[model samples]
Target: MANPSLKACFDRKKFVVAPGIFDMISAKVADGMGFDCLYVTGFGTVASGLGLPDAGIATYTDMISRIGRFAQMSRTPVIADADTGYGGLLNVRHTVMGYEAAGVSGIQLEDQEVPKKCGHTPGRRVIPAEEMVLKIKVAAEARRDPNFLIVARTDARTGLGLEEAIRRGRMYGEAGADIVFIESPESEAEMVAIGKAITDKPLLANNVEGGRTPILSKARLEEIGYGIAIYPAVGFLAAAAALERAYSHLKTAGDSNGLPASESYGFGRICELMGFPEVWDFERRWAQPAAKE
Candidate 1:
């Protein structure tokens, strides 16, 4: 099946559920689960992969490289995060091209300042709307393909309020953004408010599990007019917590055999997800023949 791009998804009107992926394994699983897209989220990558928060510590190169890996490994197209475009408007142009070259179908650029903080975190600041609009313009211009989506994200829900956030969303749409992501809404009312305010524009919403906001179901999100809902922490959070528990049990028992048997995964199940049979087939086909034949 052909992978779905952000552009194609907007018109579908159904909320696109993109589970966040930090590694090739998660990418493979997301693809296997028939997810419409893969979201290479900055927060999930930093916390799950680097053991850090999404505090602008990771570089653009690092993010793109990780995104490239997922895009290569999975059939799902990636929706990548390009935080603050790594700098100014010119920097946004470069960052846009960079992520495109990395094979992302869509890229989200936030309005947070350099050394950006987490959108859900306290003390978050934002750049002027004009500055962000210029960045969005550069991003829209830099995209080589019209199918490549440029998502404008504002951290304004915390800094300015829902009104300004919706205003920014409209301004971003006017400035050439393909979709607007109003990050980190704290309640169902705010979620409905943002969606209602940006009526004509394609809207993106974050569904980070265990984060500061309430989690809404897909049907509810679609009713609220959200085009995409990214679960950036779902897979990463589950994996981290499970692994931590397994490790604790092993350390205390000195053996995994004593751990809960129901929690185990079979080798074949993992191998299939990793495409082990295909690899073995390819290996056998290409292996050099021994002495006689």
Candidate 2:
């Protein structure tokens, strides 16, 4: 079962940090590491699942399938990125229902138009403020659980400007969005301004490492009045680096001997993580003995 609603955490005015995860194993690892929440990143999903960039190529069905697995793998609340809500207001409603049924505690809806790129990527465009507001309303109404959070994201900071992004964020908040995310603020001053401009609602900061935004610690984010800090590429980048190193060693050495022992999990430990021991115990307890000769 999933953990308690993220609303409780938000209500306390405590800053929440969610590490972005792309797959079931990453979800399990993040949950095991005691993260209170997980952000199912669309960017990571596209790169890992399709080997493509976040260019709005992933379909609604693709997102739903991955999110369902994330919801099942994570023991804590899952905040999924519902890119462009996959379409207009009606599609937003359907997206909300699908994510809710998948047990996600929060769904982030962005204002980018169809074929949206990653927030940090260039050449992105956003829908008009009025249109996005309607989508937010539809998303809010579609959720069966009132505590299920609707995070309204605006990529206007890059296309229009920070002021326009703030305007869209405020408009979406007024339309009943639970959280407002101003994607890709280029400076700490911009981040502070966003926190100040959208005071009526909780703000979410995207801490995409090596991206446009500066990666701030959770404490610094709280000081800036942001409610949530999401590290969307931390695990993915780390995993890629590790894989590159491992493969390079294997190719050069013709074996894994050159790799550091501390870098890998033991065979027994890997089995334990995969629940092999539990499977064996279940078989021993429930299976009948084989017929004797």
Candidate 3:
């Protein structure tokens, strides 16, 4: 049976803390970690693999194929970031259907215009409320599964003010979005205000490291009425820092003699983690008798 929580991911029924899984290795690691859900973060996926910023550079084809891979390989349910639904109404429909078919439990579609900037960064602007409302409606209608979620986000808090952002959140909830995400609330007070104002549906909090929002504990986020918090930058940030340190050491030392073995994954362990044991077993089972010498 499909995971019940995929359908039950509304009304703040359960709080979820989803770590961002950017690639197959991260996905495999997190899939085994007992997390109830995982987030396919756009920023990490673009930056970690493509060495590019998350600035609308990746197309839907670029993203959805990877999103499908994440979904296929992960044991945990996936909530993917679908920036601006790729385009207008028809695009919204296509994005929604595609994400659901690709096997994500939910998709977050933001209200920012195309060539959309990251939510925490500057110079972000939103579409008209009516326009995004239509997008939300189309997304909600596009999914074949009634349980599949439309996570409606408004980047109005960045360039626009918090009040406008909250208003848009409310508007989105009324438009049939399963969850309301008011992106980049800078202060706890603003977060409280969002919780207070948008009472009809569950709320989502974007917990980006070194980004605009304050990082709150799961208890505090639940206290503030957030049903889900996605830490989209955590995997990539830690991975990037580790990579820089390891590379810097190797360049300075001329060899890897000083780099700690503990710092990097053991090759054998990695092969085991990535299912090489299964391959080995298949090879053994299929092997022919050694030739006479």
The best candidate by lDDT is 2
Give the Cα error of residue 37 in candidate 2, in Å: 1.0
Measured with C-alpha atoms, the lDDT of residue 74 in candidate 3 is 80
Candidate 2 at 130: error in angstroms?
0.4
Predicted candidate 3 versus true structure: per-residue lDDT over 16-60, tens digit per residue? 888999999999988999887899999889876687998989888
User: Candidate 1 vs candidate 2: which has greater lDDT?
Assistant: 2
Q: How many backbone clashes does candidate 3 have?
A: 0
* Residue 203's lDDT in candidate 3: 89
What TM-score does candidate 2 get on C-alpha atoms? 0.97
Model 1 regions more than 4 Å off: 1-5, 287-293
* lDDT per residue (tens digit) for residues 1-293 in model 1: 12345567677665688898877778888878887788987887777668888899988776778877777777777888889999887889888888887778888899998899877788889999999999898888888888788889999888788889889999999999888899888899999998888888878878876676788888888898888888888887888778898999999989887777656566788998888999999999999878884
> Candidate 3 — which pairs collide?
none
lDDT at 3 for candidate 2?
A: 44
lDDT, candidate 2, 180-250, per-residue tens:
99999999999989887888788998988789999887888888889988998998998898889889889
User: Once model 1 is optimally superposed onto the true structure by TM-score, how far is the C-alpha of residue 162 displaced, in angstroms?
Assistant: 1.6
Candidate 2 residues lying further than 4 Å off, grouped into runs, are 1-3
Best by TM-score: 2
User: In model 3, what lDDT does residue 71 have?
Assistant: 90
Q: Model 3: how large is the Cα RMSD against the reference?
A: 1.6
